[model samples]
Target: MPPYPTGSWMPVALSADLPAGTVMPAQSPAGPVALWRTRSGRAAAFADRCPHRGMRLSHGFVRGETLACIYHGWSYAEAGNCQRIPAHPALTPPDTIRVATQHVEDGGGIIWISVGEPAAGPPRFEGLAPLRSMVAEAGIAALEAAAGTKAAGGLLDYTHDDRAVQLLLAPDGQARTLMHVLVDEDSNPDERIAASRAAEALRRAAEDIARAGIAR
Candidate 1:
């Protein structure tokens, strides 16, 4: 497997994991982010830290369309501009009082965030749909060792019980990886369950390999 690109789209979270009017903490190459979706179903990513008191915005709540910091109740819009300051109800927040945001793409049942300006959108798996996401204590090398194959284009293929499962890998750091399990769109319930369990088993194997200092 090649090294994870520094200026590419990283799959941060599964779309189903972040529903409308919700926020979740996600990892990006740049750092941590608060991935959120509005009531109207628009997805956005912002720097996890609130500018007010540096509180993690992921600890905040989502209003109708804006994310409000739980600390001072400062609400910010989808564009990352501060929209409201609860303490001064009559005052409009200045443009400078805003959180930093990243480019977000919601496609193929995945939420991808760019670390820098990318010339194209995220890669799409045409006939596959996301099953679930899990964090592995191992790195990509261990994953490749466990699966007996390398990941290409951020996707690793694993087969079990004659069923094909795709694993999307995003390196969380030097030692951790975020794994998203994907199966064929036409997969039945049993296939989906098997795929999920296979992924869990793969994760365990990879972590064990990493703990033994075998994957480098």
Candidate 2:
């Protein structure tokens, strides 16, 4: 249902895609998450459930530094603590009334989320920059078969017309996969465009292979 599980950090989205003071809905192995950022440009994720009345927190709005449930205007801090309750403005929310949080790491131009304690930080590609991301109607096996290479250290190596590309992949439970394209950090506009196109073509090929049930 999500990018990562218990001990590993998986790249969920690019850092640029999520702006400050915004919340996006996502699924996780643990549960649904409201991936959000604060006004000051910090990223955090909360269990997408509002313990108050079973509302989805992802449908909530972001305040100065808190996420407020759209239903009753109950606000929660990044740490998942209840910050304010509009109905009881004078009452401090008890510690038991709080949202659950996941481990989030924003680094290397990507956002990583982990369900439980992560063994380490997100993997870094020293000389690669994220170009774009897309979903492919294929499994990881199909992608690896099309690329003719196995994933190493969370990065899949592929060559497109003499240009090297690194693909960061997140596999959904079904046969779908989220592919994030990474290219040389020093690449020019034309090179970046080419790499992006290459990734698209690869996805098409992978999808075809998947449809034919040729990849194992």
Candidate 3:
């Protein structure tokens, strides 16, 4: 993760978490978003609630390139236009029947959703590969205390056993964070495991710091 202007890109998910032809709910500054990927592996984000009956679009199913509302079976194209209405198959759904879409970008094993119109793209963690993501039950300050260092530009570099792990942070509402763990792509399995434990330890430390409100 890299810091950007208030209205900018937010790395909400990893590419592996959102497989093609699946949808998941994610949070953004604007609110919750229905993040989905087509069978062709193209990712898109839309307002989580369906305009038809207020059902969550994330609970809907994806067929081909369209997302169908689970409640009413209304199908929406990738562009968010209503393409089919099961109730009135012969009738054309009005153009007004559409879900709001957000700009999405996928690269470096991360999915970046726009908070607004970002004048830039997501950061590229060169030579590093995303390992896993975990939610920290604390704020950035707590995380800093846990790691014994403050993150710069939303990335905290933790070096242990001569191996460095990079953390990409995304704030979720308040008193919580989403951290994407990244390590060198060619790291050995043992090293990857160590990195994972290191992250867990850091999380514990951060949570403790938060609970105690004491700097360590």
Cα deviation in Å at residue 177, candidate 2?
A: 1.5
Model 3 alpha-carbon drift over 4 Å, by segment: 1-4, 160-163, 214-216
TM-score of predicted structure 3: 0.92
Worst 10 residues of 1 by lDDT: 1-10
Checking candidate 2 for backbone clashes, the offending pairs are: none
Q: Candidate 2, which ten residues in sequence have the lowest lDDT sum?
A: 1-10
Candidate 3 lDDT, 15-57, residue by residue in tens: 9999999999887777898999998889998899889899999
Better of 1 and 3 by TM-score: 1
By descending lDDT, how would the candidates be arranged?
1, 3, 2
Off by over 4 Å in 2: 1-6, 214-216
Local distance difference test, each candidate? 0.91, 0.85, 0.86
* lDDT of candidate 1 over 36-81, digit per residue (tens): 9999999999999999999999999999999999999999999999
Index of the highest-TM-score prediction = 1
The top-ranked prediction according to lDDT is 1
- For candidate 3, give the lDDT: 0.86
Model 2 agreement with the true structure over 85-122: per-residue lDDT tens digits: 99889999988889999888999999888746777787
If both were scored by TM-score, which would come out higher, candidate 1 or candidate 2?
Answer: 1
Error of 2 at 121 (Å): 1.9
Deviation of model 2 at 118, angstroms: 2.8
